[model samples]
Target: MHTGDVTARLAELLLGARCPGCGAPGMGACAACAAGLRRMQPFGVGGLPDGLPPVTAAGAYADTLRAVLLAAKERNALGLLPLLGGRLAAAVARLVLDAGGIPSLVLVPVPSASAQVAARGVDLTTSIARTAAARLRSAGLAVEVLRGLVLARRPEDQAGLTRIQRLANRAGAFRAVGPPPSGPVVVVDDIVTTGATLAEAVRACEVGDRQVIGAAVVAATMRGGGAR
Candidate 1:
């Protein structure tokens, strides 16, 4: 294990973990909550942004999954990384394999602003992408995480924003950095709400001739069955 990984595990152990889903003590997420989270079916969100890749999510953003994501992103609950990452990996695997399985693929995580990373004490999306890459590798699929997209400028947080507001805020907000990944790319994010962020990410990647196969997320907010 890397030194950082070892240190993080030690920290989680010393902190006396609590299950984010049910507030049960003694584990980051208890087995029951884990099982509940695993009861996920991949689905797409309504009103997807224009040019957004076909997206898939491990589950709906509700109940145990929502709680776990909140704890992981808002509270620095690093212990939840493995569980969340595993779900993300599974979602991505399904997307790629259903398309006939590539020999290797790249995961492009949506970038978080520097301010957000500082406030959270971690780059949440990148960390999850790294973990998800590891899980995919272990499952015998070659995977690489290419952080090729960067924010052109920091924008206001998406919280409380309507769909149009979000689309406006995120449009033209990302740019490709350095050489783009050479293989099929799957944009990864922690959540897919209106998909404005992922759409921008896909746009940025495509700017460099990178072929984005699809997108994957840990969860998606429920919406009407058809395009809104």
Candidate 2:
């Protein structure tokens, strides 16, 4: 088969018959969508779970950006890593600067449930966290990807769950492992809906006195009025 034919078939297998970012037929993540993922406007999130560090989203989860994120996350569009990772790095940069003279950043990704990982055959959040860390390092920031957090217990899926239900579902979902981090920590996730998961991550890290400076996400849902 021709290269374009192979690509189109791949897109069909992974993300239907059209581009996720624009629904363009016979394409897998069009170039225009890749370019659209570059800009990131970090903003503070509100209504966080208590004891959760302040969180920032690279951008609102809407329009082309949402499509791009879902493309990379759900549809296995690995080619969009630089564009998506660049935006995540921007959010992490803002957190580091706001934190003031933080020598290095330790990124702890919110762990995926074992079942989910098995079903997907890939750990998407961890990949994004690593990508974000690399981007930060390229921009002259001290960065480390710490797989410090793990899922303590399987919880019901957050989809269709109410805000309170989400908070309860993730209350004890995460725990920190390995030696205590010597420096500050920043939890990273692909998306934040009600901030419950991020909060759980913060609480897990703090169980051992590790200072969680902040959290960063690729995008956040505006319906909860969290990301401003």
Taking every candidate in turn, the Cα RMSD to the unseen true structure, in Å, is: 5.3, 3.6
Q: Model 1 over residues 1-228: C-alpha lDDT tens digits?
A: 876555545655787556789866555787789987777766654568666667888888888999999999888888899899988988898787678878899999999988889998888888998998999999899899988888898777888888888878888999988876778999999998877788788888899788999999988887642111
Q: Specify the highest-TM-score model's number.
A: 1
Model 2 steric clash pairs = none
For residues 1-228, could you state the per-residue lDDT of candidate 2 as single tens digits? 888867777877775677677877555566666666665568877666666677888888999888887777677776666677777887888787777757787998889878767766777778777888898888787898888988888888788887788889888888888998777899888888888888788889999577888999888888855621
Model 1 quality (TM-score): 0.88
TM per candidate comes to 0.88, 0.86
- lDDT for predicted candidate 1 compared with the true structure: 0.82
**Best of the candidates, lDDT:** 1
Indicate the residue-level lDDT of 184 in model 2. Answer: 83
